[model samples]
Target chain A: MKRSERLVDMTKYLMERPHTLISLPFFAQRYDAAKSSISEDLAILKHTLATNQDGILETVAGAAGGVRYIPYIGKGHAEEYLGDLASRIEDPNRILPGGFVYLSDVLSNSQDLQWIGRLIATRYAYSDIDVVMTVETKGISLAQSVARYLNVPFVTARKRSKVTEGATVSVNYISSSLDRVAKMELPTRALKKNSNVLVVDDFMKGGGTLTGMEELAREFDSTVAGICVLCEADFDKEKLVEDYLSLVKISKIDTQKRIILAEPGNFLTETDFSQL
Target chain B: MKRSERLVDMTKYLMERPHTLISLPFFAQRYDAAKSSISEDLAILKHTLATNQDGILETVAGAAGGVRYIPYIGKGHAEEYLGDLASRIEDPNRILPGGFVYLSDVLSNSQDLQWIGRLIATRYAYSDIDVVMTVETKGISLAQSVARYLNVPFVTARKRSKVTEGATVSVNYISSSLDRVAKMELPTRALKKNSNVLVVDDFMKGGGTLTGMEELAREFDSTVAGICVLCEADFDKEKLVEDYLSLVKISKIDTQKRIILAEPGNFLTETDFSQL
Candidate 1:
């Protein structure tokens, strides 16, 4: 194949399998190009990605070495996307009967998920997240998005019992909003021993669900690499979990006045984008 | 930017936002390149994608003209992937109690989801699907995957009530397994009226859940573009849904004998890849 054709195919392949190492010999074999030629093609890819400040092509040197594509975003891009996201989230129409905010529209958007996923992955590019984890229903999309960018499988804990899953490891956490004990469980085989898990969710109120996930991680003898939520209720009376990150923070929600306030959360300050 | 760098960046951009139109001027301005040069870069991309039979770069002419990337897979690739999927699904270990099959592992894998999403998107690439819909739990990932490739938002119908979504449209369907009438609902604002929806799920026994989704779609004055399931149980006595596509068909699951049988489903034969 010509160099141009090889470059296009290589770019697509690398993007599809992020964090997967494709040996130089493998690329050479697929393109029928010389090792030196493949190396040069990779250089072009790496340089082009860096210039765009979007992705990183890390090349490892050794008999088992190859290239891995790390999804990332520039500081400017992150700020721009989060600002727009916060503004959209600030709309009072999203305020629900209680203090909860309706965010299904933003959660369901593919473009928004891509941007959110890329940004989160950029923060944990080197955090050594072995697997992405989230609870069932709403948070599944967010988990899948982050997993896609990290190129890892995501496991979702369920709130109810389903016969489909053979066995499960259950955990109990206080549902702060309801002021009741809530149970969450994960399939026994879904996660591995001593795995590093990154917990994510669509919304966080009092950080109760995140606490359950953290407890579940402990049950599996796994480490919590990090915890992040798409939105957090900053005005909530008290929080159950600390040391967590949120992309957007909802400071206030007045159902009577139909007013809501949202802003980019600690994710902006907590994430180090200067390396980009 | 130079032509080589432009090709790499353009390929990534188009792949990221499939089915969305990008004006030629946007690329020209981003790269600081001439319109002719940007056009030339797209031509190379289009050709490379075609030669691989993996994607389609559709160009629209005139003032609104630009480019749209349509995710697709060749017949050979589809066959290979489905074959592998079926084989993996045939493992006796996957057979659970009461003739159920464990598929959370396969559903959670990012690479597998990518292939499955691309293949399903290929089948409905031109089906004018306005949104992708599925019930909460296992199918959320599947719905999100298809939605990602289709460049549309995906809404998950919930089986239980949550304060997060204000109003909902509910439907009742016969739960063949439980032999009861089960209810499912989607938020009223989650879907738009008169939209075309593609229904998807992770597993189908009698397809009761899919039927409920169809009814919900109807309530919204929307048409069902298509219905697809990742795995369909063929051994089940009856099926509630017809005219549907399945990526893998489970012929049998003998829990006592510790045996299972599976094969590629109608998805491969039903799809017309000749247009590519």
Candidate 2:
């Protein structure tokens, strides 16, 4: 293949498999090009990605080494996306009954999920997240997107037990939204022992669900690498979890007045984008 | 930017936004290059994608000319992937108490979902689908994956209504597994009226859930563009829905004997790859 054709295919291949290593010899064999030429093609890919601040092509040295694409968005891009997302969240029509904000529209959007997933994956690019975990229904999309960028599997925890899952391990936690104790469970074979879990969700009211996921990770003898949510209800002052990050923070929601106040959360400040 | 850098960026950009048209002038402005140069770069991308039979770079001519990246996998790739997937599903250890095969592992796998998504999107690349819909729980991931590739929004039909969703439109269908009448609902604002909906799910015994989704789509005054499931239970011998495709068909499962059988379904034979 010619250099131009190789570059196009190489970019598509690397982008599809983020955080995966591709050795120089393998690329050379695939393209029928010399190792030196493959290296030069990768240099162009690496430089273009860095110039765009959308990804990173890390080159590992030695025989077992290769190039790995990391979905890393720069600070400026992150700030701009989050700012626009927050503004979109400020729409008064989104305020629902009992102070709940209707965010299913944003959650269902593929473009929004792509940006959100890349942002979250960028935060834990080097955190060694073995698997991404989320609760049923709302959190599934968020977890799936993040897992896609991280190139890892994602498991969803369900509230009700179903016969299809075979054996499962259950956990009980306070459901602050319903003001009751709620039970959730995961399939026994869904997650492996001692795996590093990244817990994600669509919304956090009092963070009761986040705590439940943390407890479930403990039951599997796994470590909670991080906790993230797409939206956090900051008006609910009493939070059940402390160590968590949110993309957008809802500071106030007046259902009667039909007003909502939102802003980019602490995720931007908590992340270090300088590692690249 | 140089031609090499432009090719890299253009490939990444078009891949990210699949099924969306991008004009030559837009690329020209983004890369600060001439329209002719951008056309040449796209030609390289189009040729590479066609040679690989993985994607289609559709060109729309006249005054509103542009390029669209359709995530289309050829018959050969589809056959190879579904064959491997079926073989994996043949593991006897996957059989559960009631003859239900454990598929959470495959469903949670990012790599598998990526392939599955591309395959399904390839089938519906030109179907003019407005949105993807699926029943909640297991189908959420499948629906989300297809939605990502099609670059459209996806909505989940919940078995039970949640407070987060204000109002819902529900339908009743017979749950063939439990042999009881069951209800499923979708939020009123989740889907738009007159949409061309594609219903997808993880498993289909009698396709009761898929029927409910189709009925729900009808309630929204939408058309059912397609119906697809990751796995369908062929041994059941009876189905509530007929117009659907399955990636893998489970022919039999003997719990006592610890044996199971699976194969690729009608999806391969039903699709026309020559459309490209």
DockQ winner among the candidates? Answer: 1
Please give, for residues B71-163, the per-residue lDDT of candidate 1 as tens digits.
988999999999999999988988888888999988899999999999999999999999999998899888889999999989999888788
DockQ of 1: 0.90
* TM-score of chain A by itself in each prediction: 0.98, 0.99
> What's the distance in Å from true for residue A207, model 2?
1.1
**Native interface contact recovery, all models:** 0.91, 0.89
Q: Write the per-residue lDDT of candidate 2 for residues B51-127, one digit (tens) a residue.
A: 99899999999779899999999999999999999999999989999878899988888899999999999999999
Show model 1 residue runs off by greater than 4 Å: none
Candidate 1, residue B143: CA error in Å? 0.7
Model 2: per-residue Cα lDDT over A97-190, one tens digit each: 8888899988889999999999999999999999999998898989999999999999999999989988999999999998999999999999
- Provide chain B's TM-score, model 2: 0.99
The lowest-lDDT stretch of 10 consecutive residues in candidate 1 chain A is A267-276
- TM-score of each candidate? 0.99, 0.99
Query: What's the CA error at residue A104 for candidate 1, in Å?
Result: 0.6
- Considering just chain B, what TM-score does every model have? 0.98, 0.99
Model 2 Cα displacement at B95 (Å)?
0.6
lDDT by residue for model 1 (A1-276), tens: 988888889999999999888999999999898999999999999999998899999999999999999898898899999999999988988988979888888888999989999999999989899999999788888999999999999999988879999999999999888889999999999999999999999998888889999999999999999999999999987888889999999998888989999999999999888666
